[model samples]
Target: MKLIKYCLILALFSPLAARAQQPAAPAAQAPIVLRPGDMQVQARSAANRPDRAPVYPGGEQALGLFFLEHIKYPEAARVKQLSGMVVVTATVNVDGSVSNPQVTQSLSPECDAEARRVVSLLTGWQPAMRRSRPLAVLIQLPVPFGTAGHMTVDQARRQPQR
Candidate 1:
């Protein structure tokens, strides 16, 4: 008799419990469009120039400060006094994530690794916009040394990777 009563109670609440457990609707995915010369331009810059360049979350000044705070001159480099620019090539994705960091220019192996490490820490950029749509762009960043030598992200963004 008690089992029958419990079964009746469970049955009454099961629909409500099931409804609560249902997953929310997924977001719609955007369609990708490709035109001729797309890869060539993106291979060069945006696939083409952007309507608006990607902004580091706060701004360029903030980015400089980020580099200053995050980048560490490697101990070996410091000991050897090997100071020069470390050019890191990275993509600021449409999702505002930094990806594919590469050391296009090397100062020292230690410095290159350190520069890559620092660049990888950066995220949450205002993605590049083209025709009012978000797009990814390849960017070169120069992290300099000796305290007064580093270029700002704006300067770095405009620079071509070598």
Candidate 2:
């Protein structure tokens, strides 16, 4: 009877002891491979004469002014007399189409959204060129917004000190 009891106890604890002694499994390794050649890398350039001219060279300035006149601050945004500057970076394709419009700086979420919306509506730009052929080129535009009394730094500087 004693021998049988001892054997039963040993069997019950043996599995638990074995589990505690086992080493953890090693983590799986990710596969690695070399990439093939022939991948083309695209380079972005600014719009310049002889290569390409701004579709709306002076028009970008006009668009900035248009926003100042048109966009009204949203009440829900708690932005009273909202004012900030927007820097739009875009690639003008060879065919004079604007692509990859990016906002480099943002003053407020609403202002940022509005800037993007306005830029998207712009069309009929002169495409940039590489070697006299139309190619994608990057351009940047800075836009300012504000209400009366909230002047831009430049505007403030130009004002006579009181």
Candidate 3:
């Protein structure tokens, strides 16, 4: 009877003992930060070539038309025609998704807002890739707003010291 009781007790505690014997999972690891020098070294080691042309979603003219048609031009701004370029920095993900679209340079607030709006609305493009993987590319778009011969900010600023 004692042997049977001991067996039952052992059976009951066997699972618990087994669980306890197993090693505990290691603690979560912290992310690593790469310094500028490390990044430079990594870049140098990477097999990136300048000769290859970057892939864009569509032709420049088509893209420009898309921007022109879709973008909301600022109507409130006194000057309608904003005549410079918008430098957009976009991160093209592996899945061909455009993330972190930002305006690096702008000529005017109206132009900037329009460019930002267009860029934000842009969907996943066929990202330029090296070795069949997507890569981030900087796209500079020269957006010329055709308005009645309006004075530019620079022109206004440089108005013969009136």
Residue-wise C-alpha lDDT for candidate 1, range 13-85, written one tens digit per residue: 9999999999977878787678776643343453468978888977877888898888777889889888678
Q: For each candidate, what TM-score against the reference?
A: 0.61, 0.50, 0.50
Q: Count backbone clashes in candidate 2.
A: 3
Candidate closest to the true structure, highest TM-score: 1
Ranking by TM-score: 1, 2, 3
Q: Tally clashes: model 1.
A: 2
lDDT of 3 by residue, 1-162 (tens): 999999999999999999999999888888778887664333444555322234446766566667668866567444544455667766555555566767787667776777677776766566666656666555554554544212345565665331
Estimate the overall C-alpha local distance difference test score of candidate 3. 0.62
What lDDT, from 0 to 1, does candidate 1 have? 0.83
Q: How far does residue 72 in candidate 2 sit from its true spot (Å)?
A: 4.6
Alpha-carbon lDDT of model 2: 0.65
Decoy 3 TM-score against native = 0.50
Error of 3 at 76 (Å): 3.1
